[model samples]
Target: MRKSSIYSVLFGTVIFTTITAALVSVSSNVAIAQILPISDRNKSENSISQVNVLFVNPSIGNDTKANGSESAPLKTITQALRVAKANTEIRLAKGTYSAEMGEEFPLIIKQGVSIQGDPGSQGKDIIIQGGGEYLSRYYGSKNIAIVGTGNAKLAGLTITNPTPRGYGLWIESDRPVVENNTFTGSTQDGVAVMGNAAPQIRNNNFYGNGANGITISGTSQAQIEQNTFQNTGFGINIAQNASPQIIANKISGNRTGIVVQASSSPVLRNNSIFSNKEDGLVVIAKAIPDLGNSSSPGGNQFSSNGRYDINAASATQQVSAYGNNLASNRIAGKVDLTATAAPVKPLSLLTRRTPTLLNSRLQRETVTPQPTVPNTDSQELNYVQIQPGTIEFTAPGAASQSSSLPALQPASTGNSALLPVPPDQIPASKTGSPYMLPPGLSQNPATIQPTPQTPPQITATTTQTGSRYRVIVEAVTPKQQELVKFIVSDAFQTNRAGKQVMQAGIFSDRNKAKNLVRQFKNNGLKAEVIME
Candidate 1:
């Protein structure tokens, strides 16, 4: 590694029995602040590799005549970026600096320049504020606060409150390191990755942003790890052929946790997704998110969402041969495979922990069978196995008893067992499958005899069934009408006179309706299904 101006010293001491003579030795600590040349701005006429340090202190800096040294620093980061050369280090002090103060918006850093904040403080003191409520270069709203082209690094700074259309950081560059930063209140997104920019975004906190916390688009690839996305619209939005490694993130309290759309294939591993208003993960239109791979363990926990934990919208888009490994994910709602076939059981519920970076050569982890699907009453399933041409249920004793029951009519060619037969529809004679019945269904087979006629089959391909009614979960007054817009964003709604009412969902399938009510109730909403 290349060594910079920063220095450190390590010491070791040992005590022996010779110290028994009431020996009380003293310990001393020492620190030295080294000063270096501000920059080699004039060195274009010559070569001065030794002068690589540039300092910026908003309070003490002089934009007109400062030499960019520890004693004579530049006034603004924009000044340093303009004068500094490649491999130059710009050291920032504690203060709030804005682009409106003679500095430019969308401050572009030169190639190979690393912008670093105070070493003693972890960015708590450095603040970079920018203008614009919405970001659009054409409209002059200044869409991005910081823009980097190549070999740029930013650390230990809080970038907040750019124009609503602006983002904290916008990278069109390649190989940037953005760490130890907090991004908040951006109207569009916290970070927008465009082009082939592959940045390392780690240990960052993104909160209360107007749009998706981070958006990766246009063939951009990034490693997003150990970040916190709270109270945002979407945690991470991957689109337009962008593929990112999203790992170890705590994504909570957002409208939707992660949305994979438009042919983006992102690797989502070891993320904790919970408390979103909508689904934890929504895969739409050919977007394939790799939850698990042979080389790495994929166990993301998803729970407490308003709808299904994972909604694989189209079956034709296959993420993997066995689908993404959801083995250890703590899912509250069932997986809604409306158009897709469910993944196989064996690969879905493997129990191995993810391998550490140092132990890449360890043998493939053992696959642990998922806990059998519990009784379908109040207990939600831990796993749903969707296999090609068959749907397998891991109910404790349901497998042996399935042979005696009437075979469920499989759906279309690729979708078998996609739709489960309701317990109430089963004939009075033959006992129903354990996986089909909710809590109070008949379990004793001796009481009823099998009907001579074949029972009606429920195919998965059918979109609607049973009743076409929705429960009005809540009624809002005229004064609280604004809240209806927020609730309607997640739930269906209708207006009557001056009042607004929220509908859990309009469902022809009773089971789906019940699941919706349960999902709404889980989010502390009073919801029930009404049969019409």
Candidate 2:
């Protein structure tokens, strides 16, 4: 029995040792399966190249062959633009650089790269001037743009004197932020943005240009805030199916200020629009401006205008006016009225076929009724023949005379007071006493006398200051109406309104108008002087 027990214990111990060994082998295999392959781990650890190019003063005239460093840098924005790839930084030093004329030297930034200007002690004093004529085709051909796919930031720089035909900065790329810049003296628009390029344009001053200050088109989104548009043809023109939020902008001294035309839906809030030529704020036929208390505060103010203050055909579309100040206009505060109502609903199976039927119904309900002609039997007879010896016939038929005429009296009573006649009454014939004018003169007649003309009295007096100049008068030709238009347009550019001033008249005496023209010129004006 003892020998059997020892043998059983030895057997049990052997079984336990065999199980333990198998479990240890399974655990080792599971640990190995949890780890990634060596080849895959090696691939994940690979690094991408990140480079930074510096543009120093010495390298401004160098080529890309030199190392892009502070001591030796590549000259010309064109070379740096070419070698810049994704995840690259091209730093521009503070200096004045002249872009070559007719050259397509656009700095095209690739996706995932940032070409930031050096925010050194100089700040954004880098000035890029285009060397070309205003009308030259090559004017704006040499500007910088982030055309490649990705996000870009243009910070701290002054971009001026672009080619006349070109814009100061043309942004067609997507999601760019143009901050803290001065755009001035371009032949065309100062800053033109097209494509679906939605950019954040803020804290900019656009002044003194041949065309609009900031022209934005295309189906782009913009947050245009705290910008000043002064002394241009049109301050800020939003057209071409573009919708943007224009808030807190000082738009003045332009020909036509804030022209919201086309199919644009701009949320104009708290903007001070004043001193324009035709109207301070003009909304054409198709503009659907979302203007109301829900928009912005201190609504648009139209004051001291040459014509209608705020002009729109009617508020038919998506335009709503609330808490706006409309004051001081020659004509009506607003012009052109057309009844506009909500769209109609289809009542029948063919309702869609007659889309305008609902609009017609609303119009009919609001229109005034027209007068109808009376029937012949119901018409009041104006004349009735009396007997030859009748008292009524001897005097005159009451029906044939005016409503003020009195009934005829008996012949025995010769009181002239009974037949009262008006002081200015005219008899039927000249041979009769107090003869009335002939029928030719009474009804649709000829020989109309000329009424005395009343000259306009100038009540309000305005004083303009400028240096006095005298030039020899060659000819005193009558001032053309177009000349007045040009002068008014020039005045609009100089003032804060940025609107065209309609010329009241062109006086032959240059001395009388000299003060006004001088004031305009001193304020950066454009006017013409013609001798009388």
Candidate 3:
């Protein structure tokens, strides 16, 4: 062994180690570039616990130090929210959690985290009540927004009682899925999505809300399907440059069944729009929707609307109306554009005849009072003499041949049969028999005649049946037109029997038709009929 040999070996080892380190460094740089750390992960991981916090029932009064567990649970949703770390899931139990009015439990989900409700568990129910008044004060301040530059998810819970400006559920995280929840009584929109977020919202029920049932805005892309909106002001509203896919929903009884506005390009398909107060589907100012062709065999069928079944304001917007059975709508004329342009004709003569009969029957029942007569009469006489108001006269002195007559003039001042005639008053042939007048004047004597009043003039207007009782079903969204037609058909069959005529068709002026529907409803019939 020589000193030179030992030194050479050590040098070779050092060189080899340097080359290996360089190679490792290059590999690490490439990996860093390809997989950047999620924004929240940039923090020190050692500072947080690996275990997720589970809050069954969080109360402000309970010990905040207690770990999230069945026996030792966090007090309030706010407390659990505070302790939740990135990628941690906070499972809540089912129970009513009360919050003070205007006091919001703000949550900033860092990255890849979820706040979920325990299935079938009590005490995890999250109720955001009066505290949401602050939400109203700060418009556009989202109740919950996942902005951690990562994906998130919320599921299986009930969100309700938000203030006028507060949103029930809001998401800004990328590729989040919000499903299997109930949103009720929201003062504003039931659910809102904003930013560049793309999410899936499905299988939810929104009812009795002040504003839109679901809203997608701010350049967000969402898949909203299999949801229901009942008694809401608007079923689904898309605005603010958002592009969403709405499919297979049941929307009814809203002011506008479905509204597409603010330059949104939503894919609406296979939705049921019926019985809404206004248009079944509405594409308002600046909305540019691309409705695909009908997939049904016969294209699309549009029929049986209480009002116009389809309406579109923008002529540039393309709507395909095929594969529908149009029938039983309450419109004056045809439902398509070709028929609307022709000269309007007067109502059919047979239809016009109906109102005359109706008016005549009503008039006869109101006019012509029954006749009445006096029960007694008074007369002046030397001796007190009574003259019956009603006298019974015999044809030949037989009871069966007698008839009663009302005394128009008082009986002669005295009983002429009992009075003695003076010699001067007696006629020449009255000596042996009763006095008689000349044959011509004796048989029939005329009494004083009264002038006749002109018969009351009876003027009746020529009756005609106008468009008063007709209805027009309308669909605001092209996606709902087919379903609208089917529902209208069903309604027509149910409503039209004897007097009510049902006819279904399309219309350009859906708003005017909706106004008429309200009028029809006021006349004891269901109006505002929409088919989606």
Candidate 4:
């Protein structure tokens, strides 16, 4: 019995040893398989000599038979996009590439594809222009120049001439790396981000855009860094509950440096915001942009703005609690907070309190700032006050019937309203009352006189500082109008209540207004021509 027991134990030990050795061998193989370094993987994937690499040259390449090689390159980017597979590298040579040749627009850059331009020569070599009328309008059907799907890369390229709502690059639901790109003459946002897209946008230039340089909304978290915005409507407009990292940007020569609206909470740091037509940063709605971190507040340089440095006064229109961290910014103007719903705690409570310009080269000293006071400008929401001078209002097509909007004319001064009007100035609706003007002015149509005066010394309203309203056609509840006023501001001139479900614009031609109404309806927005 003892011998049998010893034999059983020996058998069990042998079995256990054999099992352990086999398991160890399998584990070693698995570990080896998982041991690829990130850098090595990237190098292998992004290798230019890869089989899927394609080339595009507008001047020399032909689209019909080219296999995307250097010797026989493709003509248009559209053609390359169609044939290129995942991980494909589309290299563009020195030339102007347009989508007019092939009607494919809103050029979709597929996942894992990289579109590169000659970077050593500074992107002047490659120009990608979206030149169709339908593609240029920001809100047009085909307005976007490029749409990055995800995991795509665009480097060292110049994109220009996209119309309204048309974006130079519209990234949706993707993590794309867009670097060293120049965007100019975009009718709307140069770059528009939506969904959970967290794109790395770096070292780009945006100039002369009709709308915001970068507009990130709908939960996007873009890392926008080291970019320059000049002559754009707004440097960046963050809205719709999005949070993005805006760092080390030179936002200058724009209408507004940055507008944080809706429920956005952007991370702003180490940026130079100066020389904007409006405020350096305009925080409206419930936006709470994090301007600093724990150690020493995010220090940004703000100067030469037309209005206050940080205007959080948007709540004055409709009272709502808004909070923002303005702790460590080197502001040239006041942090206007008089219109906020609740009294804000001083920035000293949240910061370590260093006053040095950490990023600015010009100044390095710790300076104690002056006491911040609220904007003492008058709160007139309805009208912008101008100095005692003439106001001009020319009808779109009828120059002879040109006159100033009398309703906008100040009621205080009769001399405040002076515009040249011909004998046929009055519309047919007011033919009986020929002297009928907007609300407060009275003149005889029979003897309408002209007065030539110097140009008006225009002054902005408290809410609308140095900005004019444009006519909009849309339908919204009175409360929702506030949201539309900031988001689609070009749609309406004033925040006045409309009579019907929709409010239309000022158009001289009935056919144009009808066409616009049809276009709006086509886009699922109710619109009609309601001539005043």
The TM-scores of all predictions, comma-separated, are 0.54, 0.47, 0.47, 0.55
Off by over 4 Å in 3: 1-49, 59-63, 101-103, 118-126, 130-149, 294-306, 314-316, 321-532
RMSD of 1: 21.4
lDDT by residue (444-515, candidate 1, tens digit) is: 211112111111232211223444655456535432222222222223356634546665335455664564
Per-residue lDDT of candidate 4, residues 265-341 (tens digit)? 66676788887755677775456665642332556777777655675554222222122233324232223223223
lDDT per residue for candidate 3 within 1-532, as digits (tens), equals: 6999999999999999999999886775443221225674444222222345455464432433555544456656565556666656766665544454222344444466776774332112554432232231112333331222356666666665443233566665477766666665444456666666777777776765434577666566777777777755457766545667666777776545665553555655566677665456555334544333222111222333224445453222343333233333422211232221211111121122224211222222222221222222331010011111111111111011100111111111100110011112111111212222111111111210111111111111111233222344333343233322222222222243343333332222344345334322322234453332
For each candidate in the order shown, give its overall lDDT on alpha carbons. 0.52, 0.41, 0.41, 0.53
Error of 2 at 507 (Å): 27
User: lDDT of candidate 3 vs native?
Assistant: 0.41
Q: Residue 151 CA error for candidate 1 (Å)? A: 1.0
Q: How well is each residue in 256-341 modelled by candidate 2, as lDDT tens digits?
A: 46655544555555677766544456554345554433212225555664355554432224345554566434322233222132
What order do you get sorting by lDDT, best first? 4, 1, 3, 2
Candidate 4 regions off by >4 Å? 1-50, 100-103, 131-142, 293-296, 315-532
Q: All candidates: CA RMSD in angstroms?
A: 21.4, 28.8, 34.4, 17.1
Among all windows of 10 consecutive residues in model 3, the one with the lowest summed lDDT is 394-403
